[model samples]
Target: MTATHTYDVAVSWIGDRGTGTSGYRAYDRAHDVDAPGRPTIAGSADPAFRGDPARWNPEQLLVASVSQCHLLWYLHLCSAAGVVVTAYADAAVGTMVETADGGGHFTEVLLRPRVTVSEPGMVAAAVALHAAAHEKCFIANSVNFPVRHAPTVTAGA
Candidate 1:
């Protein structure tokens, strides 16, 4: 049998403005996402939907999840392959198109990862691991949109 995993979180809306959602723009879109032994994440709709800009949105979270998944897998593969990564950062961007029916879907997400390796010879190996990591990323596999990577690897010393 294949291994199985389950994730659970509770979402509580705290946007009631006394009168509640009586009309458009009547209430805030603020909410909280909580899981066991983890800090609560403040969440809201995208600012286009009258959500607070300071809070995390579902679309942004989706992109973050994909980026994080790839990062973790890349690091693990690098460690096992003796690539000796010194640093890694990704500036991931996602684009979505809004429909006339007031719905939207992501078009694509670009993962721009900059990586530093301990040795010059490891640069190529580090760069190659991104493709392998992308293939193993669960979040990327689940999303319908294209998840592209623009990775740059350099030797740190």
Candidate 2:
């Protein structure tokens, strides 16, 4: 049997500078993402769309979500498979193409994960686990675009 999970968040616009979007360039593209007990995430559109460059954008958050999901599943699998992973980091990149009408969609995401394991003997299994982790990633399974991984495994002290 399959189990179901539900997530909830609240997004509120906090960018009306007393003008309330009277014009196209009137309001700032700022908002707050809140969950029950977590710190609020300040969000905006990508700076290319007249948003603050310093604030987190939806595009970045989406890419981060994919990266985090993959990493979590990879760790879980590594533990169960007896791969002693000492360190793990991923430099994930996503590409999005915009249409002539100012709409866009992500084309793909590449997850470059650098994993440090405790022994050289475990390298092969550690390297192979990335594919399994990708297969099991919840975010990757839900996305329309392809999510690919390039993993590097090294023995660590």
TM-score of each: 0.97, 0.98
**Residue 141 of model 1: what lDDT?**
94
Q: Candidate 1 regions off by >4 Å?
A: none
Lowest-lDDT window of 10 residues in candidate 2?
148-157
Which residue runs does candidate 2 get wrong by more than 4 Å?
none
Q: Candidate 2's residue-wise lDDT over 1-157, tens digit each?
A: 9999999999999999999999979999999999999999999999999999989999999999999999999999999999999999999999999999989899999999999999999999999999999999999999999999899999997
State the lDDT of candidate 1 residue by residue for 1-157, as single tens digits.
Answer: 8899999999999999998989987899999999999999999999988999999999999999999999999999999999999899999999999999988899999999999999998988898999999999999999999999999999996
